[model samples]
Target: MIKQLPISVSGSRKYDVRSQFAALCYRIRKNKIQILLITSRGTRRWIVPKGWPMHGLTPAQTAAQEAWEEAGVRGQSDGRCLGIYSYSKETDENGHFPCLGMIFAVEVSSIADEYPEAGERERRWVSRKKAAKMVDEPELARILLDFDPRRPI
Candidate 1:
């Protein structure tokens, strides 16, 4: 279910902020951590896999599922929210809505060559620093810059 919160945009005008779940998929390579990023389907912008809440899943599970579908990631989520980031989601009706995404860390085991959205997006593995710069969301970038998988959440 989408939980909506009234947010003041400018003065008295208000907007509904919806909730989303995202996966910060990562893996260790050569003693360094690499974050997996996928291009957004509409804009082709680099972003972490994310989606609306699922009925029968926890937020972390939803994030993991999105990662698998969007980036062919096979991973296990830490089951704890790493952080929350807000963004404006563009809609098909030429409008936008506010969203708060709860980010869950998923340690990737492997990636598949073919999966859902395989033809719609491109996936890349990059350092956290590089990934932070690649994404457009400032809050998400800050989360990426400070994330340390080795530390307990």
Candidate 2:
């Protein structure tokens, strides 16, 4: 788990960060683990399916919804957070703000041919190590590389 720290967003402003939920979708095949990644809408960087919190759903449930919308995949979420990773989110109004992303493990059970963002994003499944390397965020990459379901985050 990543420790919380005060981050400066703009001049004379510092605060503890909040986080969005992310689905770390994975599947076990032939004794190997494969992780699903999707291209970001703007920069096209590879990332796990993530989104802002939604009302009436828990964080892990929200992560599952994001997975289905962004990647056309659905699965069982253990309702446990795998880890947290800090990254900078660029915004037109805020310029850039530090955001923590809480990742929840989703064991993928199905993949559809079409999803809400099907036309806007491309999804791929790769080995965990390759998925780790493909993403630009160091903390996210580290989470993927050191994933252990048996251990508490």
Candidate 3:
């Protein structure tokens, strides 16, 4: 479910703030950690796999599912969320809504050759530093930069 915050007015209009779940899918490749990112279907902007909450799943599970559908990632999602980042989501009705994304760490085991959204999006594995720079969200980028699976969040 997309939980919207109390409407807030900026100028002459009001907007809702929703919360989403995202997966920070990563793998240890050649002894170095790499993050997987996918291009947004509409804008082709780099973003982590994310979606609204699922009824029968935990937040981590929801994030993991999104990773599977969006990036073809099979992995173990951490029990705890890594962090939260906020962005403005563009609506189909030509409006913008604020969204807070809870990011979960997913340690990827394998990537599938076929998955949902395969043709609609492009996925790539990149160095954390590069991934941090490629993403548009500042808070999400900061999370990527500070990521260390061995350390506590």
Q: Name the candidate that leads on lDDT.
A: 1
When sorted by lDDT, best at the front, the candidate numbers are 1, 3, 2
Q: Per-residue CA lDDT of candidate 2, range 1-153, in tens?
A: 333232223433223335788999999888788999999998999999987776567788889999999999999787777789988787666777889999999989999998899999989989989999999999999989887555555
Quote the positional error of residue 149 for candidate 1 in Å.
0.8
* Candidate rank order under TM-score: 1, 3, 2
| All candidates: TM-score | 0.87, 0.84, 0.86
* Worst 10 contiguous positions by lDDT, candidate 2: 5-14
Candidate 2: what lDDT?
0.84
**Tens digits of per-residue lDDT for model 3, 1-153:** 233332222342223326778999998878888999999999999999998776567788889999999999889875678899999888786577788999999999988999998999999999999999999999999999888787754
Q: Any runs in candidate 3 off by more than 4 Å, and if so which? A: 1-17
RMSD of each: 6.6, 6.2, 6.4
Backbone collision tally, model 2: 0
- Per-residue lDDT of 137 in model 2: 93
- Which prediction has more favorable TM-score, 1 or 2? 1
lDDT of 1 by residue, 1-153 (tens): 234332223432123337888999999998898999999999999999998776567788889999999999889885778899999898675488888989999999988999989999999999999999999999999999999888754
Worst 10 residues of 3 by lDDT: 6-15
